[model samples]
Target: MEEAKGFVRRVLLLKFKAETAPNHVERLIKDYSNLVNLVESLKTWHMGKDANIKNLHEGFTHVVELTFEDDEGEAAYSAHPAHLEFHERAWPHVKKMVVIDYKPTSFHT
Candidate 1:
C-alpha cells in the first residue's frame, strides 16, 4: 500500500475538575478558539464530545483536534504565546488530560 502523507494531527482529551465553573471553562474555550484563529499553519480545529458512549473509560468531557502541516508547524503552535497563556489559565482546573499525535490516514466529514 502507498504511504499516506499530510499534517500531524493532535488529539487532546480533557477532563476538568468537578469544582470547575462552567462559565470559566466556556471562557477558556473561547480563548482557545481565538488562539487557533491566529495560527496560520493550523489547517483545521474541531472540539466537542465523543460520540461513542460505550467506551466511557476512554471518553472525555471535551475533545480538541488540531492539524498542522508538519513537525515545524506543530512546533510553532507549541511555542505560541497564546497557547501558553491558555494553558496557564486552564490547566489548574483540569483534573486529567490525554494527548495523542499522529499523521492522519484519512479524514471524513
Candidate 2:
C-alpha cells in the first residue's frame, strides 16, 4: 500500500461582532469554499463553528483550515484572483483576524 503524505496547514481565526448578519457570514463561507475548490494548490479545507458558551467570552466565531503541499503552493493560492475577491468581500465583515501556519509533525501511516 502507498503511504499518504501530509501537507502544511494554514489556520485562520476570525472574530466578528454579535450584530453581524448570519446570512452574510454564510454567504462568505460559501464563497471561500468555492475559491478554495478552484485553487489547485489547496489540498484540503475545513471550517469550524462558533464556540459559544453562556456567560463566557469567546474571542473568535470562525476558524478556517487549509492544507497545502508546500509554501510555494500556499503562495500561489494567496495570489489567486478568486482568493483576492473573497478577501475583498469578507474583510469588511470581519472585526479582527488571526492566522497561523505550520507543518504537520507526522505523516499518516
Candidate 3:
C-alpha cells in the first residue's frame, strides 16, 4: 500500500436504533449530504445502506464516505457550523457509530 497524497477520507459506519423510522433516516441522509454544499472544505459525500453479503457488518446498516482535499480541509469541515449542527441533530438516531479517517492509499497486489 502507498499513500495517494493530499487527500483524506472519512468513513462512517452507523447503526440506527431499531425504532428509528425510515423516513427519518432518509431525512438524515439528505441533511448530511447537504453539508458538502454548505461547507467549502467538504469535497465529496457518498452514502449507502449496507448491502454486504457476508455477515461481517456487526450491526451497522449504513455507511457514509466523505472526501476532503487534505487534513486541513477535513479539520475545517469538522469545525464548520453545518457539520456540527448536523451531528447534533443526527447523533440521537444512531445507536452505534464508528468513524475512521485516513489518508487514502493505493493497494497493489
Candidate 4:
C-alpha cells in the first residue's frame, strides 16, 4: 500500500459582528480568497458560510480552509505582506475568530 502523506491544514472560523454589513463581508471574502495568488506557500484555499442546518456553528458564520505543504509554509504565509494588509482591513469588522492548524493524518486498519 502507498504511504499516507502529511500536510498542514489551517482552519479559520470567523464570526462577524451583528452589525457588520453584508457588503463588507463580501469584500472580505474576495480579499481573503485573493491571498492564494499573492502567497506562494498556499497550496489550496476554500471558504464557505455556515449552512445553519445543524445549528452547531455557535457564532461563527464563515469558514476559511487553507492547505500548506508544512508549518513553515503556513508561517511564511502569515508573515507575508499581503496577509498583514488583509488582516488589518478585515479584523475591525470581525467580532471573533478561531484559528487552528494541524497536520492531516491517515490511518488504515
lDDT: worst 10-residue window of model 3: 48-57
Model 1 bad stretches (over 4 Å): 1-3, 55-59, 106-109
- Name the better of 1 and 3 by TM-score: 3
* Candidate 3 stretches greater than 4 Å from native: 107-109
| lDDT of every predicted structure (CA atoms) | 0.81, 0.82, 0.93, 0.90
Steric clash pairs (candidate 3)? none
When summed lDDT is taken over every stretch of 10 residues in candidate 2, the lowest stretch is 1-10
lDDT of 4 by residue, 40-95 (tens): 99999999999988899999999999998777898999899999999999999999
**For residues 9-89, what per-residue lDDT tens digits would candidate 2 score against the true structure?**
989988876677989888888888886679999988899877667724356878899998888889999999888888888
Q: Regarding TM-score, does 2 or 3 come out ahead?
A: 3
Ranking by TM-score: 3, 4, 1, 2
Query: How do the candidates rank by lDDT, highest first?
Result: 3, 4, 2, 1
Candidate 3 local lDDT, residue 55: 80
Residue 104 deviation, candidate 3, in Å? 1.3
CA error at residue 10 for candidate 1, angstroms:
0.5
Displacement of residue 32 (Cα, Å) in model 4 is 0.3
What TM-score would each prediction reach against the true structure?
A: 0.84, 0.82, 0.92, 0.91
RMSD from true fold, candidate 1: 3.3
lDDT of 3 at 90: 94
RMSD of 4: 2.2
Q: Please give the lDDT score at residue 87 for candidate 1.
A: 83
What lDDT does candidate 1 reach at residue 58?
A: 54
